[model samples]
Target: MTTLETPVPAGHRSLRQRAGNAGRRTTSDKVFNAVLTIAMVIAMVPLFVIIGYVTYRGIGVIGWDFFTLEEPPYRRAGGGYVAGFFGTLYIMGLAILMAVPLGIATAIYVVEYGQGKLAMAIRFFSDVMTGIPSIFVGLFVYGLMVSGWISVGFGTFVAAVAIAIIMLPIVTRSAEEMLKLVPDEWRNASYGLGAGKAQTILKTVLPAAAPGLITGSMLAIARGIGETAPLILTALGSVFIVTTLQGDPQAAVPLQIYNGARQPFEEGLNRAFGGALSLFVLVLIMVVAARIIGARANKRK
Candidate 1:
């Protein structure tokens, strides 16, 4: 027997067509994701290789004395990089003291109160500074503070200043971006509560962006700490462990690594490997700390 049926509506046909398109989109998304995963794995290959090679070459050199003794005489095998480690910390601490507050202040002004040519100029120069090579920055500082008649001479303080200059733009740009991420609603709420501009920024905007600020600052420090050329020109590395900031040269891991790499002896080469490994570990620790702090701040929020 023949059966009669109602014609399908245009809406139903369109819905079927949409479902087909959705299915195609799902396939495409999966393909793209797989490609991205492969690319990420490929990119990480070099990092793992480097870390493995360095660990293999340098692990034997790391011990209790490695962290407590200074570099030995030329071509000698029994010594450590205690001086470089401590000097790196000292210079970095000083540089952070000089740069972080100024960078944060500059970001605050640029975001909260800046409105004209001056603000634009500050931003323009900051971007320009970021691209300037470390060697050139070293030269600039050398000319400004070391070479001319008005010289304070090469020392830890001078090196700290140079690193601070290198760090300022990174910190400023990072902080500016973080500050920009803060919502206008938070500021409005603060204003509604009879808070002044300073109070609103301190209590609302800054706390809201604290995680990003810490991460950015830590990353900036990482970049500055790895700089060799600037420290070479400004610090004039010392063999002995120097504690004071002025009138004496300082030791740093990068300088030690550079010097060690130049030596033709096996001991020096081993020291270079050890320094490289130590530096990598230091940076890794800083990055991990930044992640933890950021996570805690997020949870608190």
Candidate 2:
């Protein structure tokens, strides 16, 4: 016996079709997600490999003496990068002092007060400056200061200036973005409270964006600290610890690494690796500290 089936309702058929499409979409999403996950893992492999290799090669050389003693002579087996470590800190500190304030000021003008051709020009130049080669910056500083014709001479101060120039654009762009992230309502509220534009920006906007500003500054510092070419031309590298900025050549970790890597000796190679590891550790510490400070600032907010 043949049975006659009733026609399905249009709504029911549409509902079934919709469910089918939804299932297919879900499957496609899963497939894409899996592909992306695999891509991400592949990308991370090189970073992990480099870190592991550096640690393997350098960890054996690191010790209390590495942190306490001056770099050993070429024939010496046991020496340290004490001068380089502190010099790195000193130069970076000076660079940060110069760059952060100017960068923040530029960002403030761009985000808060900038609205004309001049602002656009500033942004355009900043972007261009960000991509300029480090070596070129070194060359510029070398001619402007280290050439002796200008009478500035090669020293820690000139090196700091070069690094600061490299750092300025990064800080400015990052700070501008951070300032943009602050809600307009906060500014409005400050204004509603009879605060002037300057007061509003200083009290409301800056405080609100402090965490991001710190993060950006840290990024700039990270970029500047690793620069060796500029230091080569400007600081001119020293064997002994020279902390004073008074026209005296300085020893920085990057310069130490560069010099060590060029040497044919095994000890020099080992020192290079150790310097790399030290630099990596220093940057990691700074990043972590910045994160902690940002988190605390967020909590206060």
Candidate 3:
């Protein structure tokens, strides 16, 4: 070897260390990884078990008649949740109609136009709203509707108001975060091109953040779908299919599942499992569809 080559010291590593040393795992690392894997498995076990159980039990109740006819008596051999199905769609649609505009406007104001005490106060209230119990929302809506503010009966419209309240804070917070994530460069470029604030927000800022906004709104809607307490108080579940927005009690999938699961008959239990599985599948479909639409929106941008 040339003089440039250093002699190896006894029991010392060459230069830094061997390739084996670089790839070697420590005991702590192994222990931590094992713990993490165990925790993940534990967390996932309940979800997988519930899905499997519901799928196994509910499959028999899923067919054309199950979705076409109103639920039968609990003592009957067979029933369906179609009434609850339409009620759910009606409530969700109304909630969306009420929430999206207000939520997006709040988000835009928070992110672009205002970041002072007012914005902080809005954010604080939204966080508090998010943490409030669903039952409280139900109570508030019940009192409000009963106080002669709204002209509708105990049905989807009132339930929709409750759900919209639930979704508003979520959408505002989520959309604000997404809007804030949009790079400042886009705004700067718009300003540099002599675009006014309104033009920039409408033409540039919102378009860039459309995908995240869509996803956040859809997530808020999904969250609203699973809440039973508000529907119980406001909609007051009915077995009859409700085609009108108001004038009668309405059935929702969450309320249907809640009522079905508590009955003493096989019919109710079957309907419960079916309702649970159907609700899960419906939410899953919404999520999947939103993701696809969001992906396409992002790509288009």
Query: lDDT of each model, Cα atoms only?
Result: 0.91, 0.89, 0.88
lDDT of 3 by residue, 135-206 (tens): 999989988793457645587789999999999999999899889978899999999999999999999989
Residue-pair clash count for candidate 1: 0
For residues 56-154, write the lDDT of model 2, one tens digit per residue.
Answer: 888888999998988887556778899888888889889999999999999999999999999999999999999999999999989888885686787
Stretches of candidate 1 above 4 Å error? 1-31, 299-301
Instruction: Pick the lDDT winner.
Output: 1
C-alpha RMSD (angstroms) for model 1: 3.3
Task: Give a tens-digit lDDT track for model 1, residues 1-301.
Answer: 9898667876666433466478889999999999999999999999899999999988889888888888997589969999999999999999999999999999999999998998999999999999999999999888888876559888899999999999999999999998998989999999999999999999999989989999989989989999999999999898788988787889999999999999899888887898899899889899899889878876876
TM-score of each: 0.90, 0.89, 0.88
Error of 3 at 293 (Å): 5.9
Among these predictions, the greatest TM-score belongs to 1
Q: What would you estimate as the lDDT of candidate 2?
A: 0.89
By lDDT: ranked, best first: 1, 2, 3
Please give the distance, in angstroms, between residue 161's alpha carbon in candidate 2 and its true position after superposition: 0.5
TM value for model 2: 0.89
Task: Give every collision pair in model 3.
Answer: none
Please report the TM-score between candidate 1 and the true structure.
Answer: 0.90
Q: Rank order by TM-score, top first?
A: 1, 2, 3
Q: In candidate 1, which residue pairs get closer than 3 Å at backbone N, Cα or C atoms, i.e. clash?
A: none
